[model samples]
Target: MRLPCIEIIGCIAAIVTVLKLVTLDTFVFGDVQETFILFLNVHFLAALMVVFALAISAYKYLRLGIELMPIEKYVFRILISLAAFTGIWALSTEIIRYFNYQELTSAKSVSDIENAKQLA
Candidate 1:
């Protein structure tokens, strides 16, 4: 039997999403130092959500005999994905930098700095 197109698309989407999650969480970019518990949880959860959403919807279309856009439409999908991914990268970088700056600017709170300084 012919494998359904929905399955095909779902597989592709799942692979891409998981690969991205790995790259980000593994610091494959060489600069990701996010060790914060919250950020790690958020990234994993978000990736899971996106994977389930895309996979389920693709499977639905296959079972219902609905037509997914043909391969010709993939170019548009790719372009949109690129734009959204770029935006995400840009925004995450900005937020991380802002938080790091905040941490640095906070006055010393221990003797490690000067013993009787801002901690008092």
Candidate 2:
């Protein structure tokens, strides 16, 4: 049987996600840069890849075109659901942190402007 495109996509996404997570801290955070620490804390990139992979896998299973053994199907479904949940959780946490950073910066800017106006 021909392998489904979705499965291929999912596998590739999974591999890419692993590579990003492994190399992100080492290459990006290692002795070269320190200023982007906050942005890197987001973890959005890895989580997004995971979610994409899970979504594709889920779609493939839902379509029911690929003939998978019963056990294999069950295993994939469970794994996909669990992975999707984890990805969503990570994504939400990172998004919250990103938004918080934005809010803090905006507030500081507004405060600085107010202080400048008072001085003027």
Candidate 3:
């Protein structure tokens, strides 16, 4: 049996969510490039990709007008929910990591330095 479009979308959302998070980290952590730091922080490029996906999906939905069948509708919901959850998790993780990095890099304390460079 074919899977619902929503479920498929959910899977794609989940994967894309992870990708987005990883890309964000590359910017926030300063691991990617210090020169283009502003670009990463703003994430205009990623935002564009996200907007494109949503726009395409919306356009298709409007054009199809319920021709997606029950499965497809369910898939859409599942996809959207998965993406949302991934986003929440990514944001929280980034915040936590930021503070951890700040404390470590700032030379706040023995523990902070240790914690910050714990991976190193």
Candidate 4:
């Protein structure tokens, strides 16, 4: 049987999300600090796209009669999934922040020194 349009869109979005995440460094268009700032926004948008795809897929499966689970049942599933996804993302960001704490602090210090020198 042929796949539905929703499935196609979801699949394409999923692929794009994965590709974007994997090659995040290449998306930089400027210096490291600027690139990091831009990357934060891009990553959030990419994550939203992934959640959108998941929503579409869930709707398709529910309405198309693929699974016998009731709509009410899926509400819990969706909530749990969202919580899990958020938790993982939060953990990842913390890990990155922890590891790069020194680099980020140093960058700020360096910028502050430059600004002070300019004002003196």
Top candidate, metric TM-score: 3
Clashes of 1: 0
lDDT of 4 by residue, 1-120 (tens): 544565456555555654555456223433444434432555445555555655665565556564443534454355346535644563465346444554776989999999999999
Per-residue alpha-carbon lDDT of model 3 for 6-105, expressed as tens digits? 6466557746755765565434645423323332444434543554465455455546646777545654554455445545554565465556556555
All candidates' TM-scores?
Answer: 0.33, 0.45, 0.46, 0.43
Off by over 4 Å in 4: 1-16, 19-32, 35-40, 66-102, 110-120
All models: lDDT?
0.50, 0.58, 0.53, 0.53
**Pairs with backbone N, CA or C atoms under 3 Å apart (clashes), candidate 2:** none
After superposition, candidate 1 runs with Cα above 4 Å error: 1-70, 107-120
For every candidate in turn, the CA RMSD to the true structure comes to: 10.4, 7.0, 8.7, 6.8
Model 2 lDDT per residue over 23-115, tens place: 562233222122324436435555665667667766766677357655446646654765666565665555556556566668889999999
**23 Cα displacement, candidate 2 (Å):** 12
Ranking by TM-score: 3, 2, 4, 1
Which is the better candidate, 1 or 2, if ranked by TM-score? 2
Report how far residue 38 has shifted in candidate 3, in Å.
Answer: 8.6
Candidate closer to the true structure by TM-score (higher is better), 1 or 3: 3
**Candidate 1 global CA lDDT score:** 0.50
Q: Which is superior by lDDT, 1 or 3?
A: 3
The numbered model that scores best in lDDT is 2
